[model samples]
Target: MITLDLIGIGSGNPDHVTAQAAKAMDRADLILVPLKGEDKADLAGLRYRIIESCVTNPATHVQGFDLPVRDPATPDYLARVSDWHDAIALAWEAAIRPHLRPEVPLKVALLVWGDPSLYDSSLRIAERLAKRLPLTLRVTPGITAIQALCAAHAIPLNGLGAPVTITTGRALRETGWPAGSDTVVILLDAGGAFGTLDPTGISIWWGAYVGMEEEILISGPLAEVASQILETRSSARAAHGWIMDIYLMRREPALP
Candidate 1:
């Protein structure tokens, strides 16, 4: 049996790590860090920095493994994702099994980016592993990108006494913005999902590389800033090789 501690490391900032997450890192026998290829090497490096900052125990070993890419050839998106998760589960099991002992429980940890519940596959991958292994899992929450976005821009997440709908860029493109809600937050956007929406009368607060040193923020009526955001996003992504961004939108009437 293995004890898995899944800790949310927040975005790219080491300070976002919780005290519990820091303690978990010191307690784990093995910490697995996934390498998201050369374009996103900064991600792996950020995790290393977090470990270096929080962990002082030299006994706990950290290991890095190449992440398996999802097969683009799989015609069905849902099926393709299922297959990809299975592959990751296999890799995770292989990485930790050799270090496990039959008599003593092994502590294996994965540092997840942002909150594990939002736009993250670590929870899903962990569920897949549960079916094959007898494991006890513990989750330590950290600041989410949404919170970071709001904090960086100094704006409230929702309208006064109103609900905020949180959805992905893919959903915004497919279903349009949800009805009956004045505020919405979009995450995991590839680029320019705002162009798909009705820019008129809508206000947007967009942040790229939020909570990091390279952070950029833009705000205005969507109509005025949409083009600027699109161009800036493209240029930023090209220059940095990758970008992680999120945005908040609210209809007119100015939430107070």
Candidate 2:
């Protein structure tokens, strides 16, 4: 049997690795790190740095493997993602099989960027891998981008006794503002998804490379800061070759 631990390391900050996450990393026999190519080497480098700082057990093995890329040729969005997950599960198998033993329990770990359940597909890929291996999954939740974003801005997630909608940039672009909520938190924004909304009454708080040394924070009424955010986000992405950002939008007094 295999015990697969998915440990969340938080949003790019080594300090964000919780005590429990560190313990899970140290306890694992093997930790798999995904490599996204030289263009984003820093992303993989950060994971390696986390592993180096936390996993002190000389017996713990760290292996880096190339992550599978989703095929843009696939017509349907969901189908493309499903195929990608399947390929990733196969990648996991190839990386883990050599370490397996007959009728013996082994522990494997993977460091996740954020909480495995929050807009992440690691758990799904693990479950897909379980179809071929005798596997049990354990999750160690860490601080999410949403939490980090709010912390960076020193703002609450929602208004007093109010509901908040959490969504992706694609949905926000396709559907505009969601109903029944004054506050919305968006993740995985490709940049300027908020521009699709009518900025008349909304306020926005945005952050990029959050919790890291390169952190950038911006906030103001949507109309005022929208251009600044777009320009800043573009420049930041160009400078770093990669960017992870989130934003919170609220229509105070509610959008009628």
Top of the candidates by lDDT: 2
In terms of lDDT, the poorest run of 10 residues in model 2 is 247-256
Q: For residues 1-256, could you state the per-residue lDDT of candidate 1 as single tens digits?
A: 7899999888777888999999999998899999989999988899999998988888899999989999999998789989999999999988887897778888889999888888788889999898888899899887899999999989999888999999989889989988879899999788888788878789999999988889999998999999899888999999999988899999875457
- In order, the Cα lDDT scores of the candidates are 0.90, 0.94
- Expressed as tens digits, the lDDT of each residue in 193-254 for candidate 2 is 89888899899999999999999999999999999999999999999998999999998675
Q: Superpose all Cα atoms of candidate 1 onto the true structure and report the RMSD in Å to 1 decimal.
A: 1.9
What is the RMSD of candidate 2?
A: 1.1
lDDT of 1: 0.90
lDDT of 2: 0.94
TM-score against native, each model: 0.96, 0.98
